[model samples]
Target: MSAILEVENLRVAYPSRQGPVEVVRGVSFALGRERLGIVGESGSGKSQTGRAILGLTAAGGRVTADRLHFDGIDLRGASPRIWRQLRGRRMSMVMQDPKFSLNPVMTIGRQIVEAGRRGGVSRRDAKARALEMLEAVQIRDPGRVFDAYPHELSGGMGQRAMIAMMLVGRPDLLIADEPTSALDVTVQLEVLGILDDLVRDRGMGLVFISHDLRLVSTFCDRVLVMYAGRVVEEIAAADLDRATHPYTRGLLNCLPRIDAEARPLPTLERDADWAR
Candidate 1:
């Protein structure tokens, strides 16, 4: 498949008392209609890179890049008007927590309908399409789910509903940030399965960002390991065990194994140079 998104020499920084605190430094990557995983610890700037691509950085943060393109359109410093045009229709983001992402007072059905309406669907058509998406995400009672409020649903249900809403726009690219981190293990796997199915069925490009190395390897096609705002390693998901970077190796060593003998959990050793 051709490249759907591309980033080159991308940098994001925030102003501080002393000077600029850079989060992402010269990050570069290209994504096709396949799954790509970004794995890193807290404060590694993995999520910042994703937001920068979507033109959704924090107020004080600044993003600079030589090239940021989506389907041959340059996105570097693109106007807000263009972003609004593409965001919900051609591209969408699935945030980690639905409780915060979804409107508290809006009906689930109404929210999904609003999402569909961004693509110019009529209200009736939007509602019907929303119901269809709820079913696509494996919600058994689409009508009930549509009528309920975000607060009335469980965590898993809400997340699935959010997924359904995100897909209602039929976006070509979906950026999922720690999408299943708050769910139980069983629910997490189920949600991941739903994402995989969507990617396969719709040919949508996926950027799965999370801290769990094992989960990313299992759920994604390729993995990019981040350390101190920089991509330290890139490896195939199936070959993540053989990662050459010290940081990647440390992350692998730290994961608990089902068959391993009981022992002290390993910790990642950090060096000052890793921040550079």
Candidate 2:
């Protein structure tokens, strides 16, 4: 597969009372039509990197990169008109929570149809695609969900709806941020499976950002471990257990195993030098 997105020496900064605080520093990666996992703790800039790719950073924030390309388009130089054309059409994002992302007044079907319509589909065709996507995400009753409001759905249902909305546009790249964090273990796996299948069937590139190292290791093809706003390690998911970075090893050691004897879990030791 060819590269769909390429980012190099990316940095994001926000002005603070003290000064400009940098959240993401010198991050670089290339993504193809495959699942790429970004694992990091809270405040590690994982989400910021995803947002920067879609030009969704805060109003006062600044994003600078030596190279930021998405499917041969220069994201850094893209105009608002260009961004509007590309955002929902070629690239879409599934945010962390549907409760916050979805409009309360909009029906589930309306929101999904709107997503498709933004990509230039006719309203009638958009509605049909919305129903198809709802079923595609494993929702049992697509009609019931189509008419329901956001608050009427359960967490898992809401998430499935969110996925349906994002995929309704048939985007080539999907950035899913903590997509399964709020679900139960069973629901999480189900959602992940849905995403995996969709990516495989559509041949879309996925950037899966999450704090759960174990989940990412099992679900993703490759892993990028972040600490203090920078990528500290990059390794294949299958070789996650053999990670050489101290931060990656620390995170792996922190996960409690089902077969392990009863013992206290090790605490993650922080090193100031790792941030430099």
Using TM-score as the measure, which candidate wins? 2
lDDT of each: 0.88, 0.91
* Candidate 1 per-residue C-alpha lDDT over 25-46 given as tens digits, one digit per residue, 9 for 90 to 100: 9888999999999998889988
Model 1 deviation from the true structure expressed as Cα RMSD, one decimal place: 1.7
Q: For residues 223-268, could you state the per-residue lDDT of candidate 2 as single tens digits?
A: 9998888999999998999999999998888887888863665888
Point to the candidate with the largest lDDT.
2
Instruction: Find the 10 residues in a row with the least total lDDT in model 1.
Output: 182-191
Clashing pairs in 2: none
Residue 224 alpha-carbon offset, candidate 1, angstroms = 0.5
lDDT of 2: 0.91
Question: Which runs in model 2 stand beyond 4 Å of their true positions?
Answer: none
TM-score, one value per model: 0.94, 0.95
Regions more than 4 Å wrong, model 1: 185-187
TM-score of 1: 0.94
